[model samples]
Target: LHHLKTKRTEVYQDSSPFMSYSGCCCVLLPYSKCCYVLLPYSYRCYVLLTYSYLCYVLLSYSYRCYVLLSYSHFCYVLLSYSDCCY
Candidate 1:
């Protein structure tokens, strides 16, 4: 049980950045369901969507980063892609 709890916490921490970027209230439901309640519409939503999409692209491409510095470089690529696309 303790291990499950720790894993859950890790999952939440991993997703916290997306939640912060979306600027929406969200609830994690049973069976891995997530419901997001959007606040007043704004440009932030678009930016969040773009960022999330880029993250998906990077993950799909299997971009490997062995060090912390490589993660920073991955973020730089994300920013450049977002700037060009958006």
Candidate 2:
């Protein structure tokens, strides 16, 4: 709980206890079902969430670039590559 609280504080800029608990589960729980068979449930959730979150952030950034640089298709390609390959 303490660790999740701190992580929530750092990542989300919110220190509320409720936010900590909810954030922990929101950040971890969904992957539980899909990745459960891959690694220990907890570790797998952590890894999957981290990867998916980072990938999402990058893909969003690339999409923004695509919109801004619509004159070039490269950004769209990059977005597709990130979504498909990451």
Supply every candidate's count of residue pairs whose N, Cα or C atoms clash at under 3 angstroms: 0, 0
Q: Write the per-residue lDDT of candidate 2 for residues 1-86, one digit (tens) a residue.
A: 11121123233324422222212222223223211111123321122223222222222232221111122333222222211111
Alpha-carbon lDDT, every model: 0.24, 0.22
How well is each residue in 1-86 modelled by candidate 1, as lDDT tens digits? 01111111222223434433233222232343222222244422211223323222222122221111123335332222121111
Identify the leading candidate in terms of lDDT: 1
Model 2 global lDDT (CA atoms, 0 to 1): 0.22
Among the numbered candidates, top TM-score falls to: 1
**Residue pairs with backbone overlap in model 2:** none
- Residue 43 displacement (Å), model 2: 25
Scored against the true structure, residue 69 in model 2 reaches a CA lDDT of 18
Q: Candidate 2, 58: how far from true, in Å?
A: 2.4
